[model samples]
Target chain A: MHVLRPLYVVLALAVIMLIARSFWVPNDFGTHEQGYTYGWYRQSNVEEWKNFTVKYRGKEFCGTCHAGQAQKLASAHHKDIECENCHGPALFHPADPLKLVLDRSRELCLRCHTSLFYPTSQRSQIKGINPDQHNLGLECTLCHKPHEASKPGRRNR
Target chain B: MNRRDFIKLAMKGTAVVVLAKGLDGIFRPSDVQALATPLRFVFLVDTYKCIGCGFCVKACKLENEIPFDADVSRTWVERYVVTSEGEVFADTPKEARNGFITGQIDLGRGKFKDIPREKIKKAFFVPKLCNQCEKPSCVQVCPVGATYQNADGVVLVDRKWCIGCGYCIMACPYGMRFFHPVHHVADKCNFCYHRINHGLRPACVQACPTGARQIGNIKDHGDPVENIIRTQQVAVHKPEYGTNPQVYYIGLGEEVR
Candidate 1:
């Protein structure tokens, strides 16, 4: 009778633990494959991460509405660059703001155009200018059309 | 049978049932195991080709909605200036969002000094992001089970579940994790999970003017990024830690850690 008392107590504790686990742990917990290796997290969290909204919708998304600008950009030297790189992310554009903001600051242009003298680097191949000597206060867009780099004219905008 | 004998028989049966259940949990064929093909994503960084334009950094900020002025960034470029006297100086001014220019280097904590051009033996830029290790220490140390690696090998954080304990942040050997100011959760790079799954390149990869950053499915032999990983001589940061980082770096300099 004395030995059975400890066994009954252990059985009661096991029942309590089972009930607590059922209430505390989420139903979807440990729902993934290899749960032993990859700590058992709620599987639904994977979908939560996957469903995150993407703000920068690439050039293809832009081409759907602005076909002319897209075509002009494709043939230009800046074709390799995405539209969002210069114009900012088109998050819900043409609906929320009705316009995408363009960063036409001289600093934006100088990021890649400023002459960085690296003798061994391929960066030297890029057409760069001494920002101070070229045009101190004037914006690069005043003379250079970024989308159409070869064509030098004041941007209409 | 006597009452004691009957109880003993029932106990033996229950033990066998519990052992079978435990074995089943260990060996059960889950969805990933049942799949014909599993995806493995890998990233490649060509340090030689990276011109330190900082466009990727800028693009990453805009795409991920990280504040431009924030002290932390998902990706950043480090400039290594190796002096003639064999001293290596590294710095990332403003997280390299405003490209590296010839000026005084702002080593963090109010330390600023200019490394004269003549004294520099070599200089180059190395861009870094979350390595998404095969056996990630961050995932191992998350006490709340909020950080986990997906089947595709991208480690992600459950923002809702994370208690902001910062354990994952500390456990990360690469120092990739950071506390998100707005969300108050531990945030690190997920390789732009939303974009890659939609058949589009990550914002940083697309914004790279010189094609320095590349990502692709390593499981696919046809992938260009995977081909480079297979044939090229590449290296990862801190192989001694044995994190098995998925990000491969080409033209990795000896000066870089």
Candidate 2:
């Protein structure tokens, strides 16, 4: 009889815990169907996305405000590059035009972009050039792709 | 075209003219022979006109469509401010839609010092970009043949070929290269070759409200653009590195010390 009573109490507690998890036992009830809950959901799923598809194709966000500057970047293949690639997440600004977030660094470009650090992509083996001894202290974008091809003859734009 | 004919032509040609041309060799070695100096392209950044705006920082973002936390900064501008007491301040670079808003400073307010007489009368904005070198260290240091120096003198990396090793990152004297999170490879500015090849200035130059950064070819003698560099006392970042950089800084301040 004693063992049966203990088992019954244990079963009752398990059911209560299950009920608390499913229903409103403070933690679950606090965020139930609220904005805070949805916000949390967004935070968890944000990193899974790979590509950012804009409603207007090729319309750079920075260009909208700085038209003259935008025209310069678009003069060549740079036009194909998406605006957010170097800037970071810009979702808040589109809805609120004045709310702008801007940050930049050469390290950002030198790090992940394989094309800026290596010599050739055709070869299987890829390695980083020690920036210290090779070209003095110059960055790749200075002479190569700064706006357009700026080459003496074969310029793209 | 034969040596005998050339000798005859030389006899007819003025000796003084040839020697004058020969003296040209002593003065301007690069112009002495055609194809003597390799045809290399380079960029020059004029530091004075920078309004301390970070438009280039933001444009790089949209053009590359990079993530917010992305470490790659294709182009950027930094503000150097100094007070009479030798206090220096620099603003964080940003590419906001409104322009560089990282850290705001006002000369009128004189936050650098209290007394107006004691306040710093000289505070200037200096912009920085990739100093495409005549001889790129990144190209030579690349072990896998991934980073290359182009005919125009600019060094570039192939994204498809690069491995995320980051030897270049450690080797860079200016600390330009970075390792991206998603792709996990080395990346940096290509000087917007996509646009420069198209015959346009970079986004930063275009967006600059004060023409602080000027882009031009160093070899085009006929163009008036060459004067800006020739007449100015120019400086490059980390000249001790012996990179022979293309980007030049005019009127460098002692605060650089």
TM-score each candidate. 0.85, 0.50
For residues A23-89, what per-residue lDDT tens digits would candidate 1 score against the true structure? 9878887736545555468888888777887888889989999999999999987888889888988
Model 2 lDDT per residue over B5-83, tens place: 9998888687878888887665443333334333445555655545444555655555455555554566655445555
For candidate 1, give fnat to 2 decimals: 0.41
Instruction: Kindly report the docking quality category of candidate 2.
Output: incorrect
Each candidate's fnat: 0.41, 0.00
Q: Which 10-residue span in candidate 2 chain B carries the lowest summed lDDT?
A: B95-104
Off by over 4 Å in 1: A1-21, A151-157, B1-37, B101-103
lDDT of 1 at A76: 82
